[model samples]
Target: MKKMRERTRLIIQLAFAALTNGYVSGFLGQKLYKGKLKQFCLPGLNCYSCPGALGSCPIGALQAVAGDRSFSFSFYVMGCLVMLGALIGRLVCGFLCPFGLVQDLMYKIPVPKVLRKIPGDRYLRFLKYIILVLMVLVLPDRVTNIIGQGDPWFCKWICPSGTLLGGVPQVLSTPALQASLGFLFSWKMGILILVLALSSVNYRPFCKYLCPLGAIYGLCNPVSLYHLEVDKEKCTRCGACSRACGMGVDVPKAPNSPECIRCGKCASVCPHDALQFRFVHRKKEKHGQAENIEN
Candidate 1:
Protein backbone atom coordinates (compact mmCIF):
# COMPACT_ATOMS: atom_id res chain seq x y z
CA MET A 1 0.00 0.00 0.00
CA LYS A 2 1.12 3.59 -0.65
CA LYS A 3 0.63 4.49 2.99
CA MET A 4 2.65 1.51 4.12
CA ARG A 5 5.57 2.55 1.92
CA GLU A 6 5.61 5.87 3.78
CA ARG A 7 5.52 4.29 7.23
CA THR A 8 9.27 4.59 7.63
CA ARG A 9 9.15 8.28 6.84
CA LEU A 10 6.28 8.75 9.30
CA ILE A 11 8.20 6.99 12.01
CA ILE A 12 11.21 9.19 11.36
CA GLN A 13 9.00 12.26 11.69
CA LEU A 14 7.59 11.10 15.00
CA ALA A 15 10.97 10.08 16.34
CA PHE A 16 12.74 13.31 15.48
CA ALA A 17 9.93 15.40 16.97
CA ALA A 18 10.03 13.41 20.18
CA LEU A 19 13.81 13.63 20.37
CA THR A 20 13.76 17.40 20.09
CA ASN A 21 11.06 17.71 22.74
CA GLY A 22 12.08 15.09 25.28
CA TYR A 23 12.07 17.09 28.49
CA VAL A 24 9.34 15.15 30.26
CA SER A 25 9.99 16.82 33.58
CA GLY A 26 9.37 20.23 32.07
CA PHE A 27 5.93 19.21 30.85
CA LEU A 28 5.12 17.53 34.18
CA GLY A 29 6.26 20.54 36.16
CA GLN A 30 4.66 23.12 33.82
CA LYS A 31 8.05 24.67 33.10
CA LEU A 32 9.76 25.29 29.79
CA TYR A 33 13.10 23.56 29.40
CA LYS A 34 16.00 25.92 30.15
CA GLY A 35 18.85 23.50 30.15
CA LYS A 36 22.10 23.67 28.19
CA LEU A 37 20.44 21.72 25.36
CA LYS A 38 18.22 24.73 24.67
CA GLN A 39 21.32 26.57 23.44
CA PHE A 40 21.35 24.43 20.34
CA CYS A 41 18.72 24.70 17.60
CA LEU A 42 16.45 21.99 16.27
CA PRO A 43 16.38 21.68 12.49
CA GLY A 44 12.58 21.68 12.31
CA LEU A 45 9.81 24.04 13.40
CA ASN A 46 9.39 22.83 16.96
CA CYS A 47 8.29 25.60 19.30
CA TYR A 48 11.00 26.99 21.62
CA SER A 49 8.56 27.70 24.45
CA CYS A 50 6.98 24.25 24.40
CA PRO A 51 7.25 22.98 27.97
CA GLY A 52 8.99 19.81 26.90
CA ALA A 53 11.24 21.28 24.18
CA LEU A 54 14.85 20.39 24.95
CA GLY A 55 16.20 22.51 22.11
CA SER A 56 15.41 25.87 20.60
CA CYS A 57 13.77 26.23 17.20
CA PRO A 58 16.16 27.41 14.49
CA ILE A 59 13.68 29.96 13.22
CA GLY A 60 13.14 31.36 16.70
CA ALA A 61 16.88 31.49 17.32
CA LEU A 62 17.44 33.36 14.07
CA GLN A 63 14.73 35.86 14.96
CA ALA A 64 16.21 36.38 18.40
CA VAL A 65 19.46 37.50 16.83
CA ALA A 66 17.76 39.49 14.12
CA GLY A 67 15.61 41.28 16.70
CA ASP A 68 18.28 41.87 19.27
CA ARG A 69 19.08 45.43 20.33
CA SER A 70 22.43 45.13 18.60
CA PHE A 71 20.79 43.59 15.51
CA SER A 72 23.33 40.77 15.66
CA PHE A 73 23.39 38.16 12.94
CA SER A 74 23.03 34.44 13.63
CA PHE A 75 25.52 32.51 11.57
CA TYR A 76 25.08 29.68 14.06
CA VAL A 77 21.36 29.33 13.39
CA MET A 78 21.61 30.06 9.66
CA GLY A 79 24.55 27.74 9.30
CA CYS A 80 22.73 25.00 11.11
CA LEU A 81 19.72 25.27 8.79
CA VAL A 82 21.94 25.53 5.72
CA MET A 83 23.96 22.52 6.76
CA LEU A 84 20.84 20.43 7.27
CA GLY A 85 19.29 21.63 4.02
CA ALA A 86 22.47 20.94 2.11
CA LEU A 87 22.42 17.41 3.42
CA ILE A 88 18.81 16.56 2.46
CA GLY A 89 16.87 19.64 1.34
CA ARG A 90 13.37 19.90 2.76
CA LEU A 91 13.47 16.29 3.88
CA VAL A 92 13.24 18.05 7.21
CA CYS A 93 9.72 19.11 6.29
CA GLY A 94 8.79 15.60 5.18
CA PHE A 95 10.37 13.72 8.07
CA LEU A 96 11.16 15.97 11.03
CA CYS A 97 8.91 19.00 11.50
CA PRO A 98 6.55 18.74 14.46
CA PHE A 99 3.99 20.98 12.76
CA GLY A 100 4.29 18.96 9.57
CA LEU A 101 3.36 15.88 11.59
CA VAL A 102 0.38 17.72 13.00
CA GLN A 103 -0.81 18.61 9.53
CA ASP A 104 -0.31 15.06 8.29
CA LEU A 105 -2.47 13.73 11.12
CA MET A 106 -5.11 16.35 10.48
CA TYR A 107 -5.27 15.27 6.83
CA LYS A 108 -6.20 11.75 7.97
CA ILE A 109 -9.56 12.99 9.24
CA PRO A 110 -12.32 12.06 6.81
CA VAL A 111 -13.32 15.23 5.04
CA PRO A 112 -13.81 16.61 1.56
CA LYS A 113 -10.44 18.04 0.51
CA VAL A 114 -11.44 21.48 -0.67
CA LEU A 115 -8.04 23.12 -0.96
CA ARG A 116 -5.69 20.67 -2.74
CA LYS A 117 -7.08 21.07 -6.22
CA ILE A 118 -7.90 24.72 -5.92
CA PRO A 119 -6.85 27.22 -8.60
CA GLY A 120 -3.84 29.50 -8.14
CA ASP A 121 -2.26 27.26 -5.53
CA ARG A 122 1.07 27.56 -7.28
CA TYR A 123 1.00 31.30 -6.72
CA LEU A 124 0.14 30.82 -3.05
CA ARG A 125 3.27 28.74 -2.57
CA PHE A 126 5.30 31.90 -3.04
CA LEU A 127 3.75 33.48 0.03
CA LYS A 128 6.16 31.68 2.32
CA TYR A 129 9.11 33.36 0.65
CA ILE A 130 7.51 36.74 1.16
CA ILE A 131 7.04 35.92 4.82
CA LEU A 132 10.64 34.77 5.13
CA VAL A 133 11.90 38.02 3.73
CA LEU A 134 9.49 40.36 5.44
CA MET A 135 8.27 39.05 8.76
CA VAL A 136 11.27 36.91 9.64
CA LEU A 137 13.98 39.08 8.19
CA VAL A 138 13.03 42.68 7.60
CA LEU A 139 10.43 43.47 10.28
CA PRO A 140 12.33 41.89 13.11
CA ASP A 141 15.39 44.01 12.42
CA ARG A 142 13.53 47.14 11.44
CA VAL A 143 10.89 47.28 14.15
CA THR A 144 12.35 47.68 17.60
CA ASN A 145 11.05 48.21 21.13
CA ILE A 146 11.72 51.34 23.21
CA ILE A 147 14.93 49.71 24.40
CA GLY A 148 15.85 48.98 20.74
CA GLN A 149 15.28 45.26 21.02
CA GLY A 150 13.03 43.98 18.25
CA ASP A 151 10.31 41.39 18.67
CA PRO A 152 10.36 38.03 16.98
CA TRP A 153 7.73 39.13 14.51
CA PHE A 154 6.95 35.78 12.97
CA CYS A 155 6.77 34.00 16.34
CA LYS A 156 4.73 36.76 17.94
CA TRP A 157 2.40 37.37 15.00
CA ILE A 158 2.10 34.45 12.58
CA CYS A 159 3.59 31.13 13.71
CA PRO A 160 0.70 28.79 14.40
CA SER A 161 3.21 26.09 15.33
CA GLY A 162 4.34 28.25 18.23
CA THR A 163 0.78 29.09 19.18
CA LEU A 164 -0.32 25.46 19.25
CA LEU A 165 2.70 23.61 20.60
CA GLY A 166 4.25 26.38 22.75
CA GLY A 167 1.70 29.06 23.63
CA VAL A 168 -1.20 26.76 24.43
CA PRO A 169 0.89 24.48 26.67
CA GLN A 170 2.57 27.35 28.48
CA VAL A 171 -0.68 29.15 29.16
CA LEU A 172 -2.42 26.03 30.37
CA SER A 173 0.42 25.33 32.79
CA THR A 174 1.16 28.76 34.19
CA PRO A 175 -1.74 30.65 35.78
CA ALA A 176 0.13 33.95 35.62
CA LEU A 177 0.84 33.44 31.90
CA GLN A 178 -2.85 32.74 31.35
CA ALA A 179 -3.78 35.98 33.07
CA SER A 180 -1.23 37.87 30.92
CA LEU A 181 -2.66 36.50 27.69
CA GLY A 182 -3.81 39.45 25.63
CA PHE A 183 -4.93 40.26 22.10
CA LEU A 184 -1.70 38.78 20.75
CA PHE A 185 -2.46 35.40 22.24
CA SER A 186 -6.04 35.58 20.97
CA TRP A 187 -4.78 36.41 17.49
CA LYS A 188 -2.31 33.55 17.57
CA MET A 189 -5.06 31.12 18.67
CA GLY A 190 -7.26 32.25 15.79
CA ILE A 191 -4.43 31.61 13.36
CA LEU A 192 -3.78 28.21 14.86
CA ILE A 193 -7.45 27.22 14.54
CA LEU A 194 -7.56 28.41 10.95
CA VAL A 195 -4.36 26.54 10.10
CA LEU A 196 -5.63 23.32 11.68
CA ALA A 197 -8.95 23.65 9.86
CA LEU A 198 -7.17 24.15 6.56
CA SER A 199 -4.85 21.22 7.23
CA SER A 200 -7.85 18.90 7.40
CA VAL A 201 -8.58 19.80 3.76
CA ASN A 202 -5.07 20.41 2.46
CA TYR A 203 -1.83 18.52 2.79
CA ARG A 204 0.63 20.71 4.70
CA PRO A 205 -1.07 24.03 4.10
CA PHE A 206 1.30 25.79 6.48
CA CYS A 207 4.41 24.24 4.94
CA LYS A 208 3.21 25.02 1.43
CA TYR A 209 2.02 28.56 2.00
CA LEU A 210 3.40 30.03 5.20
CA CYS A 211 6.47 28.40 6.77
CA PRO A 212 9.56 30.60 6.62
CA LEU A 213 11.77 27.71 7.59
CA GLY A 214 10.38 25.71 4.69
CA ALA A 215 11.08 28.59 2.35
CA ILE A 216 14.74 28.55 3.38
CA TYR A 217 15.01 24.80 2.93
CA GLY A 218 13.23 24.99 -0.40
CA LEU A 219 15.92 27.27 -1.73
CA CYS A 220 18.57 24.77 -0.76
CA ASN A 221 16.81 22.04 -2.78
CA PRO A 222 18.81 22.85 -5.88
CA VAL A 223 22.17 22.39 -4.22
CA SER A 224 21.28 19.68 -1.70
CA LEU A 225 23.61 16.70 -1.83
CA TYR A 226 20.73 14.26 -1.56
CA HIS A 227 18.35 14.51 -4.54
CA LEU A 228 15.94 12.62 -6.77
CA GLU A 229 17.12 11.46 -10.19
CA VAL A 230 15.25 10.36 -13.29
CA ASP A 231 16.17 8.04 -16.13
CA LYS A 232 14.73 9.97 -19.04
CA GLU A 233 14.99 7.02 -21.43
CA LYS A 234 12.98 4.82 -19.07
CA CYS A 235 10.30 7.46 -18.57
CA THR A 236 7.27 7.42 -20.90
CA ARG A 237 6.15 10.94 -19.92
CA CYS A 238 3.49 9.35 -17.74
CA GLY A 239 2.20 11.54 -14.91
CA ALA A 240 1.86 8.97 -12.14
CA CYS A 241 4.71 10.54 -10.17
CA SER A 242 3.12 13.97 -10.34
CA ARG A 243 -0.25 12.58 -9.41
CA ALA A 244 1.17 10.94 -6.32
CA CYS A 245 2.86 14.16 -5.27
CA GLY A 246 0.78 15.76 -2.52
CA MET A 247 2.95 18.82 -3.00
CA GLY A 248 1.93 19.06 -6.68
CA VAL A 249 5.56 18.79 -7.85
CA ASP A 250 5.96 18.00 -11.55
CA VAL A 251 8.33 15.15 -10.98
CA PRO A 252 10.54 14.23 -13.98
CA LYS A 253 10.02 17.79 -15.14
CA ALA A 254 11.31 19.26 -11.90
CA PRO A 255 12.35 16.44 -9.61
CA ASN A 256 14.26 18.85 -7.41
CA SER A 257 11.57 21.48 -7.30
CA PRO A 258 11.71 23.68 -4.23
CA GLU A 259 8.20 22.61 -3.30
CA CYS A 260 9.27 18.98 -3.10
CA ILE A 261 9.34 17.89 0.53
CA ARG A 262 11.32 14.70 -0.13
CA CYS A 263 8.18 12.70 0.69
CA GLY A 264 9.30 10.04 -1.86
CA LYS A 265 5.71 9.62 -3.09
CA CYS A 266 6.71 10.40 -6.67
CA ALA A 267 9.37 7.73 -6.62
CA SER A 268 7.04 5.20 -5.00
CA VAL A 269 4.38 5.63 -7.69
CA CYS A 270 6.68 5.65 -10.73
CA PRO A 271 5.41 2.72 -12.78
CA HIS A 272 8.53 2.65 -14.92
CA ASP A 273 10.74 2.58 -11.85
CA ALA A 274 12.51 5.52 -13.41
CA LEU A 275 12.81 7.68 -10.31
CA GLN A 276 15.14 7.33 -7.33
CA PHE A 277 16.96 9.37 -4.71
CA ARG A 278 20.74 9.71 -5.07
CA PHE A 279 23.73 11.29 -3.40
CA VAL A 280 26.45 13.35 -5.13
CA HIS A 281 28.30 10.34 -6.54
CA ARG A 282 27.05 9.06 -9.89
CA LYS A 283 28.19 6.97 -12.87
CA LYS A 284 28.77 8.62 -16.22
CA GLU A 285 25.67 8.59 -18.41
CA LYS A 286 24.99 9.08 -22.12
CA HIS A 287 23.90 12.57 -23.05
CA GLY A 288 20.13 13.09 -22.72
CA GLN A 289 19.65 9.50 -21.57
CA ALA A 290 18.95 10.44 -17.91
CA GLU A 291 19.68 13.24 -15.47
CA ASN A 292 18.68 15.01 -12.32
CA ILE A 293 15.60 17.09 -13.01
CA GLU A 294 16.35 20.80 -13.30
CA ASN A 295 14.80 23.69 -11.40
Candidate 2:
Protein backbone atom coordinates (compact mmCIF):
# COMPACT_ATOMS: atom_id res chain seq x y z
CA MET A 1 0.00 0.00 0.00
CA LYS A 2 2.82 2.37 0.86
CA LYS A 3 4.60 1.56 -2.38
CA MET A 4 1.40 2.08 -4.31
CA ARG A 5 0.89 5.52 -2.77
CA GLU A 6 4.45 6.53 -3.50
CA ARG A 7 4.14 5.29 -7.08
CA THR A 8 1.01 7.40 -7.49
CA ARG A 9 2.88 10.46 -6.28
CA LEU A 10 5.75 9.74 -8.67
CA ILE A 11 3.30 9.47 -11.53
CA ILE A 12 1.73 12.79 -10.58
CA GLN A 13 5.11 14.45 -10.42
CA LEU A 14 6.05 13.14 -13.84
CA ALA A 15 2.71 14.15 -15.29
CA PHE A 16 2.98 17.70 -13.96
CA ALA A 17 6.53 18.00 -15.26
CA ALA A 18 5.55 16.78 -18.69
CA LEU A 19 2.39 18.85 -18.86
CA THR A 20 4.21 22.07 -17.97
CA ASN A 21 6.87 21.38 -20.58
CA GLY A 22 4.67 19.77 -23.25
CA TYR A 23 5.55 21.90 -26.21
CA VAL A 24 7.30 19.09 -28.00
CA SER A 25 7.22 20.95 -31.29
CA GLY A 26 9.05 23.88 -29.71
CA PHE A 27 11.54 21.56 -28.06
CA LEU A 28 12.25 19.72 -31.30
CA GLY A 29 12.47 22.92 -33.30
CA GLN A 30 14.40 24.80 -30.62
CA LYS A 31 11.81 27.54 -30.33
CA LEU A 32 9.87 29.14 -27.49
CA TYR A 33 6.16 29.89 -27.49
CA LYS A 34 5.25 33.51 -26.96
CA GLY A 35 1.63 32.69 -26.28
CA LYS A 36 -1.21 33.83 -24.03
CA LEU A 37 -0.63 30.97 -21.58
CA LYS A 38 2.79 32.44 -20.89
CA GLN A 39 1.01 35.37 -19.24
CA PHE A 40 0.01 33.16 -16.27
CA CYS A 41 2.38 31.60 -13.77
CA LEU A 42 2.62 27.89 -12.98
CA PRO A 43 2.24 26.66 -9.37
CA GLY A 44 5.70 25.15 -9.42
CA LEU A 45 9.19 26.24 -10.49
CA ASN A 46 9.24 25.91 -14.30
CA CYS A 47 11.29 28.28 -16.42
CA TYR A 48 9.30 30.39 -18.87
CA SER A 49 12.32 30.76 -21.13
CA CYS A 50 12.52 27.00 -21.69
CA PRO A 51 11.85 26.00 -25.30
CA GLY A 52 9.05 23.63 -24.30
CA ALA A 53 7.56 25.49 -21.33
CA LEU A 54 3.94 26.61 -21.72
CA GLY A 55 3.52 28.85 -18.69
CA SER A 56 5.54 31.37 -16.69
CA CYS A 57 7.36 30.49 -13.47
CA PRO A 58 5.91 32.15 -10.36
CA ILE A 59 9.29 33.22 -8.96
CA GLY A 60 10.42 34.48 -12.37
CA ALA A 61 7.13 36.32 -12.84
CA LEU A 62 7.39 37.87 -9.38
CA GLN A 63 10.90 39.05 -10.11
CA ALA A 64 9.90 40.37 -13.54
CA VAL A 65 7.10 42.41 -12.00
CA ALA A 66 9.36 43.64 -9.22
CA GLY A 67 12.04 44.67 -11.70
CA ASP A 68 9.63 46.27 -14.16
CA ARG A 69 9.79 50.03 -14.24
CA SER A 70 6.01 50.35 -14.68
CA PHE A 71 4.99 48.17 -11.75
CA SER A 72 5.84 48.58 -8.06
CA PHE A 73 4.20 45.32 -6.94
CA SER A 74 2.94 42.12 -8.56
CA PHE A 75 -0.55 41.60 -7.21
CA TYR A 76 -1.25 38.80 -9.71
CA VAL A 77 1.90 36.83 -8.98
CA MET A 78 1.71 37.27 -5.19
CA GLY A 79 -2.02 36.47 -5.15
CA CYS A 80 -1.45 33.28 -7.14
CA LEU A 81 1.38 32.17 -4.86
CA VAL A 82 -0.62 32.95 -1.69
CA MET A 83 -3.70 31.17 -3.00
CA LEU A 84 -1.75 28.04 -3.91
CA GLY A 85 0.20 28.08 -0.64
CA ALA A 86 -3.02 28.47 1.37
CA LEU A 87 -4.55 25.57 -0.53
CA ILE A 88 -1.70 23.05 -0.44
CA GLY A 89 1.49 24.65 0.89
CA ARG A 90 4.63 22.76 -0.18
CA LEU A 91 2.61 19.94 -1.72
CA VAL A 92 3.31 21.82 -4.94
CA CYS A 93 6.99 21.33 -4.28
CA GLY A 94 6.49 17.60 -3.69
CA PHE A 95 4.13 16.92 -6.58
CA LEU A 96 4.38 19.70 -9.13
CA CYS A 97 7.87 21.22 -9.21
CA PRO A 98 9.98 19.98 -12.13
CA PHE A 99 13.15 20.97 -10.32
CA GLY A 100 12.04 19.00 -7.27
CA LEU A 101 11.45 16.01 -9.50
CA VAL A 102 14.96 16.42 -10.91
CA GLN A 103 16.43 16.51 -7.42
CA ASP A 104 14.45 13.44 -6.38
CA LEU A 105 15.73 11.53 -9.41
CA MET A 106 19.28 12.63 -8.68
CA TYR A 107 19.02 11.29 -5.12
CA LYS A 108 17.77 7.95 -6.48
CA ILE A 109 21.10 7.33 -8.24
CA PRO A 110 22.91 4.37 -6.63
CA VAL A 111 25.74 6.13 -4.84
CA PRO A 112 27.16 6.38 -1.33
CA LYS A 113 24.59 8.92 -0.17
CA VAL A 114 25.05 11.17 2.85
CA LEU A 115 21.84 10.60 4.79
CA ARG A 116 22.96 12.18 8.06
CA LYS A 117 22.45 15.84 8.88
CA ILE A 118 25.45 18.12 9.20
CA PRO A 119 26.19 20.63 11.93
CA GLY A 120 23.84 23.67 12.05
CA ASP A 121 21.43 22.02 9.57
CA ARG A 122 18.48 23.50 11.43
CA TYR A 123 19.92 27.01 11.27
CA LEU A 124 20.78 26.65 7.58
CA ARG A 125 17.13 26.02 6.69
CA PHE A 126 16.48 29.70 7.35
CA LEU A 127 18.76 30.63 4.42
CA LYS A 128 15.93 30.15 1.90
CA TYR A 129 13.90 32.83 3.66
CA ILE A 130 16.84 35.22 3.49
CA ILE A 131 17.24 34.49 -0.25
CA LEU A 132 13.53 35.03 -0.77
CA VAL A 133 13.59 38.37 1.01
CA LEU A 134 16.79 39.79 -0.43
CA MET A 135 17.26 38.27 -3.91
CA VAL A 136 13.67 37.54 -4.89
CA LEU A 137 12.02 40.62 -3.43
CA VAL A 138 14.22 43.45 -2.16
CA LEU A 139 16.95 43.57 -4.79
CA PRO A 140 14.54 43.31 -7.67
CA ASP A 141 12.24 45.95 -6.22
CA ARG A 142 14.80 48.43 -4.93
CA VAL A 143 18.07 48.11 -6.89
CA THR A 144 17.83 49.85 -10.24
CA ASN A 145 20.24 51.14 -12.89
CA ILE A 146 20.52 54.66 -14.38
CA ILE A 147 17.37 53.98 -16.44
CA GLY A 148 15.33 52.87 -13.35
CA GLN A 149 15.35 49.17 -14.23
CA GLY A 150 16.53 46.23 -12.18
CA ASP A 151 17.48 42.69 -13.11
CA PRO A 152 15.89 39.43 -11.97
CA TRP A 153 18.72 38.63 -9.62
CA PHE A 154 17.52 35.23 -8.49
CA CYS A 155 16.80 34.02 -12.03
CA LYS A 156 19.99 35.54 -13.37
CA TRP A 157 22.35 34.43 -10.60
CA ILE A 158 20.84 31.52 -8.65
CA CYS A 159 18.09 29.51 -10.36
CA PRO A 160 19.57 26.21 -11.47
CA SER A 161 16.21 25.34 -12.99
CA GLY A 162 16.56 28.24 -15.43
CA THR A 163 20.13 27.24 -16.21
CA LEU A 164 19.12 23.64 -16.84
CA LEU A 165 15.85 24.16 -18.66
CA GLY A 166 16.24 27.58 -20.27
CA GLY A 167 19.81 28.83 -20.53
CA VAL A 168 21.41 25.57 -21.54
CA PRO A 169 18.75 24.62 -24.05
CA GLN A 170 18.61 28.07 -25.60
CA VAL A 171 22.36 28.37 -25.85
CA LEU A 172 22.71 24.91 -27.35
CA SER A 173 20.00 25.64 -29.88
CA THR A 174 21.20 29.09 -30.82
CA PRO A 175 24.82 29.52 -31.92
CA ALA A 176 24.42 33.27 -31.42
CA LEU A 177 23.70 32.72 -27.69
CA GLN A 178 26.90 30.68 -27.37
CA ALA A 179 28.96 33.46 -28.95
CA SER A 180 27.39 36.05 -26.60
CA LEU A 181 27.95 33.94 -23.42
CA GLY A 182 30.19 35.71 -20.90
CA PHE A 183 31.20 35.63 -17.22
CA LEU A 184 27.61 35.75 -15.90
CA PHE A 185 26.55 32.76 -18.00
CA SER A 186 29.65 30.86 -16.96
CA TRP A 187 28.97 31.66 -13.29
CA LYS A 188 25.35 30.45 -13.55
CA MET A 189 26.55 27.26 -15.27
CA GLY A 190 29.06 26.70 -12.48
CA ILE A 191 26.32 27.05 -9.88
CA LEU A 192 24.15 24.55 -11.78
CA ILE A 193 27.00 22.04 -11.94
CA LEU A 194 27.72 22.45 -8.22
CA VAL A 195 24.04 21.98 -7.35
CA LEU A 196 23.81 18.87 -9.54
CA ALA A 197 26.90 17.39 -7.90
CA LEU A 198 25.63 18.12 -4.38
CA SER A 199 22.11 16.80 -5.18
CA SER A 200 23.58 13.34 -5.89
CA VAL A 201 24.93 13.17 -2.32
CA ASN A 202 22.35 15.25 -0.42
CA TYR A 203 18.61 15.04 -0.70
CA ARG A 204 17.23 18.32 -2.04
CA PRO A 205 19.95 20.66 -0.79
CA PHE A 206 18.36 23.46 -2.85
CA CYS A 207 14.88 22.88 -1.44
CA LYS A 208 16.24 22.80 2.10
CA TYR A 209 18.60 25.77 1.86
CA LEU A 210 18.07 27.92 -1.24
CA CYS A 211 14.70 27.71 -3.03
CA PRO A 212 12.86 30.99 -2.47
CA LEU A 213 9.63 29.50 -3.84
CA GLY A 214 9.83 26.77 -1.19
CA ALA A 215 10.43 29.47 1.42
CA ILE A 216 7.22 31.25 0.42
CA TYR A 217 5.11 28.09 0.46
CA GLY A 218 6.72 26.93 3.68
CA LEU A 219 5.53 30.03 5.50
CA CYS A 220 1.94 28.97 4.71
CA ASN A 221 2.37 25.31 5.79
CA PRO A 222 1.18 25.88 9.37
CA VAL A 223 -2.12 27.36 8.21
CA SER A 224 -2.52 25.66 4.83
CA LEU A 225 -5.82 23.97 4.10
CA TYR A 226 -4.11 20.65 3.49
CA HIS A 227 -1.70 19.39 6.20
CA LEU A 228 -0.53 16.36 8.13
CA GLU A 229 -2.57 15.56 11.27
CA VAL A 230 -1.03 13.50 14.03
CA ASP A 231 -3.35 11.31 16.07
CA LYS A 232 -1.82 11.50 19.53
CA GLU A 233 -4.13 8.78 20.80
CA LYS A 234 -2.76 6.23 18.35
CA CYS A 235 0.87 7.35 18.33
CA THR A 236 3.26 4.90 20.05
CA ARG A 237 6.29 7.27 20.00
CA CYS A 238 8.30 4.72 18.00
CA GLY A 239 9.69 7.47 15.68
CA ALA A 240 9.06 5.44 12.51
CA CYS A 241 7.36 8.38 10.86
CA SER A 242 10.32 10.62 11.54
CA ARG A 243 12.71 8.03 10.17
CA ALA A 244 10.68 7.71 6.98
CA CYS A 245 10.63 11.45 6.45
CA GLY A 246 13.15 12.57 3.80
CA MET A 247 12.85 16.27 4.68
CA GLY A 248 13.94 15.61 8.30
CA VAL A 249 10.61 16.44 9.92
CA ASP A 250 10.06 15.16 13.49
CA VAL A 251 6.60 13.82 12.74
CA PRO A 252 5.19 13.32 16.24
CA LYS A 253 6.36 16.71 17.47
CA ALA A 254 6.35 18.91 14.38
CA PRO A 255 4.21 17.13 11.78
CA ASN A 256 3.13 20.48 10.41
CA SER A 257 6.62 21.94 10.26
CA PRO A 258 7.09 24.35 7.36
CA GLU A 259 9.71 21.99 5.94
CA CYS A 260 7.18 19.24 5.38
CA ILE A 261 6.24 19.01 1.69
CA ARG A 262 3.05 16.98 2.32
CA CYS A 263 4.64 14.02 0.51
CA GLY A 264 2.62 11.59 2.73
CA LYS A 265 5.60 9.30 3.43
CA CYS A 266 5.16 9.77 7.16
CA ALA A 267 1.49 8.79 6.98
CA SER A 268 2.23 5.83 4.71
CA VAL A 269 4.96 4.50 7.00
CA CYS A 270 3.05 4.93 10.27
CA PRO A 271 2.36 1.43 11.61
CA HIS A 272 -0.50 2.65 13.78
CA ASP A 273 -1.93 4.83 10.99
CA ALA A 274 -1.54 7.72 13.44
CA LEU A 275 -0.52 10.22 10.79
CA GLN A 276 -2.94 11.52 8.15
CA PHE A 277 -2.92 14.00 5.30
CA ARG A 278 -6.11 15.99 5.81
CA PHE A 279 -7.79 19.35 5.48
CA VAL A 280 -7.03 21.50 8.52
CA HIS A 281 -10.57 22.86 8.65
CA ARG A 282 -12.04 19.38 9.09
CA LYS A 283 -10.99 19.44 12.75
CA LYS A 284 -12.68 22.81 13.11
CA GLU A 285 -15.83 21.34 11.61
CA LYS A 286 -15.83 18.52 14.15
CA HIS A 287 -15.27 20.99 16.99
CA GLY A 288 -18.13 23.17 15.77
CA GLN A 289 -20.42 20.13 15.65
CA ALA A 290 -19.47 19.12 19.22
CA GLU A 291 -20.11 22.68 20.45
CA ASN A 292 -23.54 22.75 18.79
CA ILE A 293 -24.48 19.41 20.40
CA GLU A 294 -23.34 20.61 23.84
CA ASN A 295 -25.39 23.79 23.47
TM-score of each: 0.95, 0.94
Who wins the TM-score comparison? Answer: 1
Give Cα distance to truth, residue 27, candidate 2, Å.
0.7
Candidate 1: deviation at residue 208, Å? 0.7
lDDT of 2 at 128: 97
Residue-level lDDT of model 1, residues 227-273, one tens digit each, is 98887767788999998888888888888999999989888888888
**Local accuracy of candidate 2 as per-residue lDDT tens digits, 1-295:** 7899889989999999999899998889987888899999999889998999999999999999999888867899999999999999999999999999988888778898775464688999999999998998889989998877788999999999999989989999999889999999999999989888788888788899999999999999988988877766678889999988888988888877889988888888899987778774443345443222110
* Shift in Å, residue 28, candidate 2: 2.0
Please list the residue runs of candidate 1 whose C-alpha ends up more than 4 Å from where it truly belongs after superposition. Answer: 286-295
What TM-score, to 2 decimals, does candidate 2 have?
A: 0.94
With candidate 2 superimposed using the best TM-score fit, by how many Å does residue 51's alpha carbon deviate from the native? 0.5
| lDDT of model 2, residue 288 | 45
